[model samples]
Target chain A: MCELMALSANVPTDIRFSFSGLCPRGGVTGPHRDGFGICFYEHGGLREFKDYLPSCQSAIAEFLKSYAIRSKTILSHIRQANVGGVSLENTHPFQRELWGKVWTFAHNGQMPIEQVPQPSYYQPVGTTDSEKIFCWILSELRSAFNADVCISQVSAYLHSLCNRLNALGINNILLSDGDAIFAFCSTKLHWVARKAPFGEAQLRDCDLSIDFASVNSDDHVSVVIATEPLTKNEQWLAMKSGEGRMFVNGESSWHDFGPEIIHKKSEPTKIAS
Target chain B: MCELMALSANVPTDIRFSFSGLCPRGGVTGPHRDGFGICFYEHGGLREFKDYLPSCQSAIAEFLKSYAIRSKTILSHIRQANVGGVSLENTHPFQRELWGKVWTFAHNGQMPIEQVPQPSYYQPVGTTDSEKIFCWILSELRSAFNADVCISQVSAYLHSLCNRLNALGINNILLSDGDAIFAFCSTKLHWVARKAPFGEAQLRDCDLSIDFASVNSDDHVSVVIATEPLTKNEQWLAMKSGEGRMFVNGESSWHDFGPEIIHKKSEPTKIAS
Candidate 1:
């Protein structure tokens, strides 16, 4: 499988320490050596870099080690290659523009690719099922509303889309539009929040630790979500098999993905050979 | 050159529409067809996929058209291979674990491979300077904290390390440890935020437009950052050269990378090629 990492904080913070422990799994301390990428939001836009190289050996990854790009919200990934070929075009953290804002995305599961109705305004660039899914959703949103939909309406639209995605199978995913973070879980997902009573954390894959108290003030609150627990001593809350949650400014905005209906009655559809 | 996309919203929103426009540039609409990868954060962890084919024609990107893996904070990237060989092992969006959190990263620029210091706790699995930089940074954090430093201290320590990295050549980067997003500007970086008075935006590279009023709420604040402006008629802020900034929950926290110091005053100090 693949691994994911994200940060949503009330204040901007650096991720170098945490990344130090997680990157080794990609063909080093572990086995997720397919590819990787990361995204950071700044001044209202997203800045990102991606590569088809293993995180353990990528020059970009090394630069990130010391680069220290900081954002209030961040998303990152390391690939293990279960589906697509390993090429630069297949790297994680894919991006697109809609409604004037840039949207960034990455995924960690394999889905049976299915042919779907193409959207009038959006189309896929790659053959990955993940990008196709994102495009379809955006098209749906554009068609559903004009340039005046309310926030509640937008949320409802997304809620319906999440339901549709879960129906597709193995729909664990993360998305952001530089305002909030939305996390939907079809399988494995976990999260933790660090606030006033912050403590030290230890890495599970590597010999490393950090004391959050030293970097955060009393007003700072931070939350983290990942595919696997990155530390040995921290309590990570695993999402139920089918649960979609939203985090805004380091707080959880719980949105039930609702009951999952397995499509055992329908024949599995395939897209790519 | 590669293209990057991200979303940080108050709710779960699919970037498929925006990404659809960006994907074409991968090879179909533009030129960055080397490879593609994307990661989505669901619940507390991440799910990701990568392909070693051009995003323009890759089945993986095609599948993403309909997949709606949503997150409040998302990061996505498309590659154009500036360094390392074009194999799956060299794709972007690398992931690792540290202090109990998964850290994800990706890069867009090339770095001199010989400038990096050899790492002890983390090491590169690929031959790219990106991965090497990632390992070196992680190792430094591990060494500085020794698995028992406070998180605040860890952040402070990272700030110092980031200062060192900013001194390196052209270090435009994004980083996250699952708490906050960190962004650094070296050469090219631009951003824009969409809020209350949101309006229509058109893609600079494609014939796509989205009226923000239809998809966003007044309460919904978003920020978009990129190496280049993605849209026309929007106020895109150019990051000051050689400066690093951080964003937390759609807000920016500016930090000076400190005074610039020349890496090599002469030739003898430079590592032999």
Candidate 2:
């Protein structure tokens, strides 16, 4: 298993605070120390940083901590390497281009590589089952629709694919195409939406804290999803097993909770602080 | 226009010295300072660093200069932005995966985007004419051959595509699949190979000199290709107007001079130091 984290915001926001809490889990505080990767969607393109070194020891990770790159959507993962060998190619957050959009995917669970279907459109450069699964998903998306199709039109198909993968094992996934974030949970996933009335929060794994009220603007709304709650004083909503959600501009566009799917346009829910 | 640089080496080598010369052209010494990108093919995987800021002002470029990641093959580009707007997506050294290998491409000249045929397989993530040409080439490759085809078998087809693009405008190109480099020149491209008896060399753009004899091993061999001669002391070979050459393991695998092709299997040229 690995740790997955993501952010979706109405404005460009940095993930330094959340990333700091997750770094310790890579080696110092937990066993997940194989490699790590992070992708920030900025300026209508993707900026990716990946290393085979553990996050605790990676120089790139240390540089990233001090470098504040603001982005509206971000996806990151720290791996423990269960199925593939430790290599730069096996690092998480694999990226591909489809329909003139850069799509990134990162997985947090181990699936049977042999059981996964081979992809037709995209091919995996790495030997990880995570990469194979990502390619398979992209291949399916390309086969089902044309290049001009909107993502909202294929939400049902994407959710079906997520459910099919969830049936095999824990398939906590975070996927983004620079515009929106698609999160699916199989075993463990939690999220927190921060808007107005932001207060202070303390890190769970490290000796650090951030005062959100001082840092955020009144109209700034953002949602952070992670494998586990990164803060102690925040209320995090745990997603039920087999639940899938799509977030755009810091708001949940739709929620597929088992059988029933609820669109945010029809049933808008207030963001839980 | 842009500054293009590439390296093909028998062993893993760092391109810091050549890159140092190219960095200043982004903003300080020259006017081609829109953005910069570099991709290092290391450990059968690719590590890329790109910034929209000028290379002279980019923090990532500064960090990369000190990081010293070694690779057997590398490609770098600094853009001036002629057709496309200055953005991360428009940055050079565009990458795509084909035959399970990450192929990188960088162009130093402009081509008419309207005249170029649209690609059917790979889509351009950016709005640059350079990217469209790269997509068209890859799409043609995928259409002509199967995924399992060897690169050597498609060298002639690739050369034909290069010639086709060269007819439109200046199309100096540097492309690689991590194992070999394919360099084509329509107007300006130069290369220099370094071998056992390495000597001191001075940079033309920067006030720095390096005694390669002390730093490189006796068996080390590397070929550096750039849009113009990077070193003042080195003897660089300028490719003909429509010449295309492929280098592997620091040696010219084949050289196509106009209508005739010379295979390395028949005439292996010695490394020129």
lDDT of 1 by residue, A1-273 (tens): 588888888777788877877799888887889888888876444556566679999766776787666678888888887655675445566655444344566676666656443545455544567766666776687678764443233665676676666665565677776567777776678998878887899988788899988988888887888888888888889987557777778878656756754443244324232
DockQ of every model listed? Answer: 0.02, 0.58
Mind giving the per-residue lDDT tens digits that candidate 2 earns over B95-148? 888888788899987655777778988899888999998998888998888888
Give Cα-based local distance difference scores for all models. Answer: 0.66, 0.85
The RMSD of every model to the true structure, in order and in angstroms, is 23.6, 7.4
Docking quality level of the chain pair in candidate 1: incorrect
Per-residue lDDT of model 2, residues A1-273, tens digit only = 799999999999989999999998899987889989999988767788888889999999998999999999999999999888888888889988889888999998766687677898899998988999999999999998888865556777888998777665557788888888888887788999999988998999999999888999999999999999999989999998778899888878898887432223223223221
What lDDT score is found at residue B160 in candidate 1? Answer: 59
Q: Where does candidate 2 chain B have its weakest 10-residue lDDT segment? A: B264-273
Model 1 per-residue lDDT tens digits across residues B39-105 = 6554455555566578788666776765555556566667887667654445656555454344556
For candidate 2, the docking band is medium
Q: In model 1, where do residues sit more than 4 Å from their true spots? A: A115-119, A148-153, A261-273, B1-273
